[model samples]
Target: MNDSVNRPADGAPISVVLAGGGTAGHVEPAMAVADALTALHPDVRITALGTARGLETRLVPERGYHLELITPVPLPRKPTGDLVRLPGRVRRAVRQTRHVFDDVAVDVVIGFGGYVALPAYLAARGGVRRRRVPVVIHEANATAGIANKVGARSAQRVLSAVPGSGLKDAEVIGVPVRAAITALDRAAQRAEARAAFGLPDDTPVLLVFGGSQGAASINRAVSAAAGELARSGVAVLHAYGAKNTLDLRTPEPGDPPYVAVPYLNRMDLAYAAADLAICRSGAMTVAEVSAVGLPAVYVPLPIGNGEQRLNALPVVNAGGGLLVDDADLTPRFVAEVADALLTDPPRLSAMTSAAAQVGHRDAAERVAAVALDIALSGRAARGRRR
Candidate 1:
């Protein structure tokens, strides 16, 4: 009766397939848990399932994991031609996923609720000649997406970042963020991080960015306030979308510098360098920002079912962050609120503690531990059947 999930009863290495791709929101949590699984058992086999069209094509391989691409089955929200063809697309994707499952001898399927997860869930549930495997689901959004809502039915374990993600029985495990984020020492790294970003060490820095592609509204508002912020002794690091351009003026010799980059590869450094952040409140963003203990003014994307607002509200209510509607995020608002906060050390320090309190730093390891246990149990059950 060994309690270790690192090895099965037969001493075979556990194989896991993570299905969460398309968006950074889905892909990041999956990767975080994948990293955690490997850290727990170095010999464990980990694979990622994604489509050619998703960011996982780049993100998965860069993290040094094997990626299997399958036909994407997009769920249409309304009655359309795509909806009519949904069944056939799902069948094809499921068939392709089943092949990957067999190739890897996957013992467990861990899904993060995206276009890539449904087929993997169905394939693992057993159909036709498919073999059944344990399924674990992690829903990272405040509102569960279509794929996760379906996958939750037969999952061996269901997890979510928040309580009301539409997964009624989901265990609240928090969103899984990378270890680099959870282990960050912002105070210790601040000097090096500011230097890395070509920023002044003594200035209060405001880190602003949308998602990977950047947010147009956020970009416009933040960039427009660059002059006012710099004049007020606040340095600005703005990551406008790659495709978008800003019309900000060059800083005067005595003013705090305004640094604008298209993207941020080292978020750990960015978090270390900033006193305050103005950004979108995606589940992943909220989790990462709070995990690093960085205070933020979260501007929810004004679309969908107000899920982004819901994502930020708990943290905001806890005094870890602020919630600003997209429509209200103008230059004047940035000057009055963001500028005032950046200058207030007492408020920022209080918010930092509150944000850290809301973040689950061990979420990845918790998910990995449970997933491994489920995998081991499945393997032992199969052994008994033989």
Candidate 2:
């Protein structure tokens, strides 16, 4: 795709573009791969492609990457008023993204699958510009998103964060998680992790959370059952999300302590302190806990194509986690199931090993290496053509 001089000045950096963003689920993986690329190839020039309206607008820059902004053009799942305008909107986004690719002389384009990714994939495939480049796509959801489904056919390689992602022949590489989590050693940091969260060193701790805004059902159920868990000598570390508030279950004189917070920016500490988790089965959440070898009770969001259930199924099947329907995750269920598992050290230990076995701590590095290799191959092809 580089139509300029046959080669750059000696020692010039190899350029790579990462595309995706909307939620932290998409952004974090892109950033993790960026981090891996920077670490592994010091001479690499990293560029992020995302929409102005996505989390990447702020997060990518904050992480020290140059983010190229484009307009967001969301596709309607069904025929709607938005469908009439989609063609023009998508065309405009593709043009903008194509400009970015040409401007950067991109050697390869890697997409993590989101609204922005569709345009990046198109641009990398040459689109109206007639400048083809190698394309790599990563699907982080258990079910492939529309962008990934469309992009995978044209990609040089397809990667999935979880099993059963519905992408044909896609390699299961796990999610590219935050380095903090992949490096966490719960066994080594157990005491320090508990102390960091003001948790008792000797008691079993159960961690509960939903998504970022918090799941109202989880909050209500877990908050109501906190007193029961405390009475059973089990402590709690609950993240109520920034938008929701927990009706605190006041600890009595002889009860185990309960810690509640509006948000947990330091999930590393939470994962380290937790003996088990009761949380949603978002791809990132599943990947992180599985990487750290933490057992969990997953309550998938009852909305959208039922992908969350698919996300937790592999772990649950592997004996590393349990998937409970959202409607069934009541206070009684939490107590009976979560408590039963937490109290059984032998079961938890086996589950821990099972989870670790399925997780990939080096996923970021592995994905980065794949992208970099394609970039190198693309350059070599260009050299031969010259």
Candidate 3:
């Protein structure tokens, strides 16, 4: 994979087309790698491919990149109406994507697997030597998604965030996380970050969240134990979903702050302010938390193919965190677990070090390096052939 991206000549420029996004989990990593590539070589041209319906329509552009639209081809779980239309819809999407590759003159196609990735993968393998392009895939989950499984077959390099992702010959490159997280110095920023959240400077905090929409099960269970956690001498930063009306406001006077807000606009600040975290185990969340060296209690969402549970297993096994079943997340259980960890500084310190050992803060640069090498190698290969 490292054949000739040794460096690019003056006049030659590398262009990339990145594909992913149905949720922040898929979109954010793609954006992070794009950012890393631009940082490494400002002249590198980058474009993105996403479905009209995914979060990419908002996030990709907000991150300052052009996003070409494609039809979403979500694999149906069972025999359904959409399943029948899958073949025709996918064919049209691939046709449209081929035009995008031509329009961009894409040197390499990189994908963080999602509903839109299969089309991008198909377009890159244009059925001819002249049109064929090198492909790289990044799998964000411990258990691979269907799109990634297919993309891996033809990808020049396949990268996985955790082990057991089911991508053949996959290299574990960790997840590409934002620079703010990668460069975070929690100790230096702790005073300011805690103050901004109305928390005391010298105290333990438990940051609880359930991704963008918030987790009702997590919220309900945690909120119920708010008093217990406070009595145990820990501050709480609860990001209730924007639509939630439930209040876990501090009841008794002189209790450590239990700051409950609808959403956390600045996640970096939240991470800087917290000592430990209790959140749903999504791939991105696990990556970010571990990247920051914060220990966590991961409650995997009880849906899908049990991938969420799989995502946290590696860290948990490494002594970096704990895993709790969604069904077992009662108020009593949450309070006892959080209190035990918060009150024990030795355990907290050890876990932080363990998480640091497992986390990959420079993964963005590493994955970007692979993508650039593949692109440069393809260009050199073509030139030699000519």
Give the winner by TM-score. 1
Runs of candidate 3 exceeding 4 Å displacement: 1-7, 10-12, 128-130
Give all candidate RMSDs, comma-separated: 1.3, 3.2, 1.8
User: Which sections of candidate 1 miss by over 4 Å?
Assistant: 1-3
lDDT of each: 0.91, 0.86, 0.89
lDDT by residue (tens digit), candidate 3, 157-191: 99999877899999998999999899998889999
Q: What pairs collide in candidate 3?
A: none
Clashes of 3: 0
lDDT of 1 by residue, 223-286 (tens): 8887788778899888887988878977788988888998999999999999999999999999
Model 2 stretches astray by more than 4 angstroms: 1-10, 127-129
lDDT string for model 2 (262-337, tens) is 8898899899999999999998888898999999999999999998998888888999998899999888887887
The better-scoring model by TM-score among 1 and 2 is 1
Candidate that would win on lDDT: 1
**What is the alpha-carbon lDDT for the whole of candidate 3?**
0.89
